[model samples]
Target: METGFPWGSAPSVDLSLWRADAIVLFDWLMSTDLNAVPITHPAQKQALADLLARLEEVGITESTEEEIAAPRKMWQGHGLGGAPIDQSSVTRAQGSMTQDIT
Candidate 1:
């Protein structure tokens, strides 16, 4: 089985995210201490840095705490399907995931 791509090979993929979601993601990534995450290779670190650069290039930068918090609060109880989500449960899950990574 082919386990991975050859060296220097990069496949392109397109990602589409809502602006609010992208803002939240960019904030999280920017605030994260990647050295604490178990990255296996230097390329992974470079890729993350590259992603941050791309986000900034498109004007996503350090937002005020209020700006970062607003989107999370706004979407807390709603899902893409407009179904109600359990805010507390989601919060707990996010907390645990953050703990696991950090």
Candidate 2:
């Protein structure tokens, strides 16, 4: 649970406790708070690198560096100018969407 400090709280889960082998960890970061934590120190960097390697060894091509760096697809023509979107949504938008009645 010692994630160097100040982190380990966002998304409110202990990143160090859970199995680095779990794909959910990566997905959680990507979908929850992508910028919540920065892996700058050598320890954090190595931990992440190990996770990626483990993911690769288990045949998970989804977390590849190239794929992660590749441009994300957009919700075309949303007037958002090609903003990025989360990779998954297990629930409703949690906000209202009004109809444009003409």
Query: Once superposed on the true structure, which residue ranges of model 2 sit more than 4 Å away at CA?
Result: 1-40, 62-71, 74-102
Candidate 2 lDDT, tens digit per residue, 1-102?
Answer: 222344544222323221222444454433543234575676776556555544445544555654333222222433366445544431133123221111
Model 2: how far residue 41 lies from native, Å? 2.3
TM-score of each: 0.53, 0.28
Q: lDDT of all predictions, in order shown?
A: 0.65, 0.39
lDDT of 1 by residue, 6-75 (tens): 5755655555554566678789788899787679898898778766766776666755778678778877
Candidate 1 structure lDDT: 0.65
The alpha-carbon deviation from the true structure for residue 95 of candidate 2, after best TM-score superposition, in angstroms, is 19
Q: Over 4 Å off in model 1, which ranges?
A: 1-12, 62-66, 75-102
RMSD of 1: 10.6
